[model samples]
Target: MQENQIDHLFQQGFSLHQQGRLEEAQVIYESILKLQASHFNALQLLGVIFLEKKQFIHSINLITKALQIQDNQAPCYYNLGSAQQGLQQYEEAIARYDKAVAINQEFAKAHHDRGVALQELQRLEEAITSYENAIAIQGSYPEASWNLSLCQLQVGNFHAGWRGYEWRWKNSEISKTAGLRNLKQKLWLGAESLQGKTILLHAEQGFGDTIQFCRFTRLVSQLGAKVILEVQPSLVSLLQNLEGVSKVIARGDPIPECDYQCPLMSLPLALNTDLNNIPGVPKKFITCC
Candidate 1:
């Protein structure tokens, strides 16, 4: 109940928070709030813990209370923005991120997250600007670069988009889900000729993505390369008769020996595909469901 006692509890909570002990920190922070209802630091940090725990509504309420007690705190605004983002409230999140950056121009994560919110709203240009701002503030921000690439691709800026798309290897979610393949063969990314060589084109994402990009196998074949396509098991039978593919095998099956390899999604970049020149869906592959 004493001021020093509250401070000691806060310090303990903050230490636990920094160590990623969310439940323990939450208990300490809750105790601090009970003694001093308007305890700004306790409210703000607890709000962050709730955000990390995916308790978005609770995070929003606590962060809002913290901001009322101390309106000038930039981190509180940023946390509020993240909580809003977790709730898919893009407009509100953008407002909070705007406030955070207005208070501290060097807030790179705020700028990047603001870009994400804007991108969700389909505001591609604004999202690109926000991502660029984040990158300017922190030159090594790969997440921003990767999101910027998606925006660029959406707007048909293929030259810049494909170049920026390489940053996906550094984006955490994409890396975790569809990681870079450790291959003995060289990665073909539009630089080398596939002529007189066999190239393994494997699916890296969803079945839909594999189906959509499989059209590029014909283009690869046109370059005089033998194309061996590896796709999801469900699509192996469906895609077996696809044009220009020498072999179509299910993923997890033994892939044939090839001199070059590329993920299906990366084929657009590897083949220098553009908006006007995108290969059409071949008639043979289309059957009405």
Candidate 2:
């Protein structure tokens, strides 16, 4: 096929993708590969399409081919890294992300993805730094901020982490509800301590996060304040036994007056959590209260 014909096919594929005709786009991209087997753009885009289709291995193969043909293409490495991540080949994904970052230090997506791979590998501290780098490089990606916060929590840098985690409210999946206080409250920033006041911790994230962070109520309450826990139904029974909790309520319900309210994920930020001071539960998070 002529160069122009191949380019036209590529453009058509891209248009289809933009129109959300992913299967049609993939077919065209694959056809471009048949005409020009080493076509860099075709392979790279097809790799991305495969990734979207959840065909991780195929995406990896296509992206690796594209990378070989165009070693300098940052997007190729990013897509390759993503494909590797989808396949749970975290080390390899991190390596690809490293290459992407090295090629373009300002590549915010690369740093974000690398942090994700590091997090998956349990390299918590390093992951947090990578996430911070991503935020520094590009402040627009909400997931980067949210993931960084979780990483900080994992490493016990609670204060910074919880603030980062609050980006969850911006996520499409997170249900937004106006708390007693404004959603813009600084509870995660620990701008004010809970000393001599009521602190309401509204549940955020999954059930497991509520179970894990409920332990912080004991410390918060012990500091001479009441700790109100806004929890999910599944976790309420388990959380009632956690020390320091004065009350538990379901989400979206109006609660009693409190001096401060924070998301459950923000406990780390409020307590300045770190490896030495993670909010952990020593006893059963469930059972006799």
Candidate 3:
């Protein structure tokens, strides 16, 4: 194909990609490669489409080919990092993200993703620094802030972690997946007086988070609040017997009217939990069936 024809096909493929028609875009990119084996855009974007499709190895191969054709493209390294991350090759992903950042100092997303890779590798301090760098580059980056919170929590920096944890609400993906309650009631974040009032403690994360934090329900009740706990359906039977909980409602059930609300994960922060004084697991909370 002539140069103009290749550019036209590339534009068409990119347009399809922007429309999220990955399969069609992949075909067009592949056609471009058939005419020009070393076509940089075709290889790079096809690799990205494969990465989106979860074809990690193919994604890596194509992206590597793109890098060979043009080593200076920062996005190529970033996409290569993503493919490595998909395969759980954290160290490789970090190296690729590092290269991306080295190529473009303003690459905030590369720094953010490098932090994710570092966190996966259990390098919490380094991950925190990486997240901070990303935040410094892009102050309004919700994902980096949210991840920095996790790294802080992992290292037992409760004050900063929980404070930053609130950024999860700013992340559209997390907010969508975790399904934040849209109640107009105020969120009780420890300082609120629960005296003579009903408090709704809803589970906003996975089962493990609910199990771990349900211990706070008793503490809430101890403060003279009517504690209504909402948990996943699978845990309703187990938690129904929990002491101090006035009512245990399964998720999806209509939540009773409450004066305040809080996500279960935030209970620790609300209760002023720390590494040394973290609440012990309730003896009967976990038992074999």
- Candidate 3 lDDT over residue span 78-124, tens digit each: 99999999999999999999999999999999999999999998999
Model 1: residue 147 alpha-carbon error in angstroms: 1.1
Question: Which scores better on TM-score, 1 or 3?
Answer: 1
Mark the regions of model 1 whose C-alpha exceeds 4 Å error after superposition.
281-289
What are the per-residue Cα lDDT tens digits for candidate 1 across 41-80? Answer: 9999999999999999999999999999999988889999
My TM-score estimates for the predictions, one after another, are: 0.93, 0.75, 0.89
Candidate 2 lDDT, tens digit per residue, 120-235? 98898788789889989887778888787777666655556666666776655543531223544345346666678887788766677677767777777877778888888777
Worst 10-residue stretch by lDDT in candidate 3? 280-289
**Which of 2 and 3 is the better model by lDDT?**
3
Higher-scoring candidate on TM-score, 2 or 3:
3
